[model samples]
Target: MTGGATVTGEGRTREPRDAVRARLVDVAVHLLRDRGPDAVTTRAVAAAAGVQAPTIYRLFGDKDGLLDAVAERAADDFVAAKAQAARAEAHRGADPVKDLRAAFWAQVEFGVANPEVFRLLGDPARVLRSGAAQAGRAVLQARVHRVALTGRLRVPEGRCVDMVQSAGTGVVQTLLATPVPDRDPHLVGAMWDALVAAVLVDGAGSADGSGAAEPTASATFVAFRALAPQLPGLTGAERALLVDWLARAETAAVQD
Candidate 1:
C-alpha cells in the first residue's frame, strides 16, 4: 500500500499520509458539528476530503474508527488549551485553587462552545478508555493531588476527582439541555462552588466555602472506593463486588 498520496481539497493538495488522514478527520468533525453525526457518512467525508472511499477505510478502518479519531482530535485540542492555561497560571504564580477554578472554567467554556464534540465525550466508559481522555484526567488528577498535598481536600484524592468530574459534566450537560437563550449563565459558577464546597475544607482550596456541603460519610466512602483496588485477600469477584458497593456508596454520599 502507498504510504503517501496526493489528496486535493479546497484547491490544495495534501501529500503525506498523515496529512490526508488529518484532512478527513477535520472534514468529519466539521460535518459532525454543523450537520450532526448523521451527516458524517463515509461518502460525505470522502467527498469533503477529496479522497476515495477506500482511503478512509485504509486510514481509519471504518466509520466508527473515523469517529474515534475525530473524538481524539477534539479531546487533544481541549487538553492542549487547558494545558496552556495551566502553564500560564503557573507562570503568573496563581493559587492552586484558582488554577483549578480557571481550568474548570476553561472546560465549561470548551464544552459549551463545542456541544457536539462534548456529547461524544460525555460517555464515561469512552473517556475512561481513550488515551486523550486519560491525558485530560491526568491533568485533573494532578490538580486535585496538589489540593490534597495542601491538606485542604476534605475527601480522599479519588473522591475529590470523581466529584469534580461529576459536577463539571453535570453542569455542562444541564446547560446544553436548555435552549441557548434560556440557559442560565450563572449555573457553571454555582456548580463549581458546590463542587468545591463538597470536597474541600473550610477556607481551604476553595475561594468561597467551608467543609463539605454534605457530611463526611460520602467522602469516607469515596476514600474507600479509592482503596478498593489495593485491598488484599479478596478474590477477583469479591473485589469487583466491593468496588460496585463503593460506587453505590459514592452515589449515596452526594445525596447526603
Candidate 2:
C-alpha cells in the first residue's frame, strides 16, 4: 500500500477496479477544487489516490480523458437531480414557462456552485463528444417539447433550446466574472423574462391549431417536427421519414 505497492492474489488487486478508479477521480476532484485545474496533474492524482501513475493512464487513457470522466461524472449527477425534480414537477402539471424558468435558475446555481466542473463541461469539444452532454440536452429538449405541446412555444423548439442554453451560459459567466458583492441580483430574473418573451406567444396555443396559435403554418410544422424524434413505437427509419415530411411541410408552409 506504500507508494502503490500491490497487495493481491496472483497479480490481481485486492480492491475492485471500479473502486480504485473512483478513488482517483475523487482525488482529482479535490485537487481541482482546492488547488485549481493546474494542480490536478496525473502524478499528483495518482499519488493522492494511492495508485501508480500507469493506473491512471490505464483507467482513463490520459489527463484529458481523466478530466472528461470527472466532468461527465459531475454532470451526470447534476442532470439526474434536475431530471428527477422535473419529473416530480411534471406529475404536478407545472406550467411550462414556469418550469423552464425554474430550470434556468438551477443551471445558474450549478454553474456558480461548481465553477471548475462547469467550465470543463463548457468546452466545445467536450460538449460535442460527451454522452453526459447529450443526456443534459435530452432533458432540456423534453422540457421544451412540453412547452410546444402546450402551444406556448412561438419559435422552433430547437431555437428556443439554443436561446435558453446560450443565455444561461452567458449570464452565469458574467456573474462569475463580477466580484460576489458587485454581481447584479436582478440579472437572472431579467434575462429569463426577456428570453421567455422572445420565445413564447402571448397566449397559449394557436387559434387555428396549426402552430402554438400563431398565424404562421411554418410554426406549427416546426413544433410538430421537434416532437417527431420522441414518437414511441417508431423505428429509426420511420422517425427519419416523419422528420423529412415535416421539413417539407415546413418549407411549403413558409413559401405560402
Candidate 3:
C-alpha cells in the first residue's frame, strides 16, 4: 500500500503500475497475434490480465487506447531489433544497399504478419503524428543515410527515405490485400530490386563497408549533413545553417 501499488489480503505488495501495464499489453498482443484484433476488446484483455474491467479504462482510456499501447510497444521492439541486427550486419562487412533491402523485406514481413496492428497504425493522419511511426521512419532514414555515407545512394537521403517508406507501405498493403494462400512471396524482393535500381547508381554497392567511402559530389553533402551536429568550431545556429546548406546542395545535385 504505497505510491503506485497496493497490498493484497496476504500483506504482499501487488504488482507495480508499470508491470501491470506491461502484463495487459502482453495479453493484448497475444490476443492480437493469436485471436486477431477483434478479440482484443477491453473486457477480453481485462479478463485475460486478471484485472477488473475498469482497470483497463483507467490505464488505457478505452479499447482503442489499449490497442494503441500494444501497437506502440510492438513498434518500439521492432525498431530496436532492427537496429541491433543492423549493427551485427555492419560488423560482417555487409553492403549498405543489401542491408537496406534486407530491412525492407523484414518490414514487409512485419506488416503482413501483424495485419491488425498494421491497419491500426497505417492511418495517414495518425502515422503523421505518431511517435512510434516517427521512430520507425528514423530507423529507415538511418539505413538510407548509411547508404549515402557509402557513396552508393544517387538521390538525396531525405528523398530516398520518402521513396523507400512509400514503396514499403505499398508492398505491405498489396500483399495484405491478397488472400493468404495466394500471397506472392517474391513480391518483396522484386519490388526491392526495382527500388534499389531507381535510387542507386549502376555498380553502386560498396565492399569498403559501412564505415566510409570516397565521397561523391552528392555524397559529400550527404555525409556532411550527417556530421553537421558534431562539427566543431560551430555554434548551434551555425550548425543549423550548415545542415540547411548541405540539404539544399544535395537536393539540387540529385535533381540536376
Find the candidate with the highest lDDT and give its number: 2
Please list the residue runs of candidate 3 whose C-alpha ends up more than 4 Å from where it truly belongs after superposition: 1-5, 8-13, 91-93, 125-129, 205-242
Report the Cα lDDT for residue 51, model 3: 92
For each candidate, what is the lDDT?
A: 0.78, 0.82, 0.81
The Cα RMSD in angstroms, rounded to one decimal, for candidate 3 relative to the true structure is: 3.8
lDDT of 2: 0.82
Q: Per-residue lDDT for 143-179 in model 1, tens only?
A: 7755554555566677677788788888889988999
Which prediction has more favorable lDDT, 1 or 2?
Answer: 2
- Give the range where candidate 1 is weakest over 10 consecutive residues by summed lDDT: 206-215
Better of 1 and 3 by lDDT: 3
Show the lowest summed lDDT stretch of 10 residues, model 2. 204-213
Give the best candidate by TM-score: 3
Provide the TM-score for each candidate, comma-separated: 0.74, 0.80, 0.82
Please, what are the lDDT tens digits per residue for candidate 3 over residues 169-193?
8999998899989988888878877
Candidate 2 residue runs with Cα over 4 Å from true position = 1-13, 203-256
Clashing pairs in 1: none
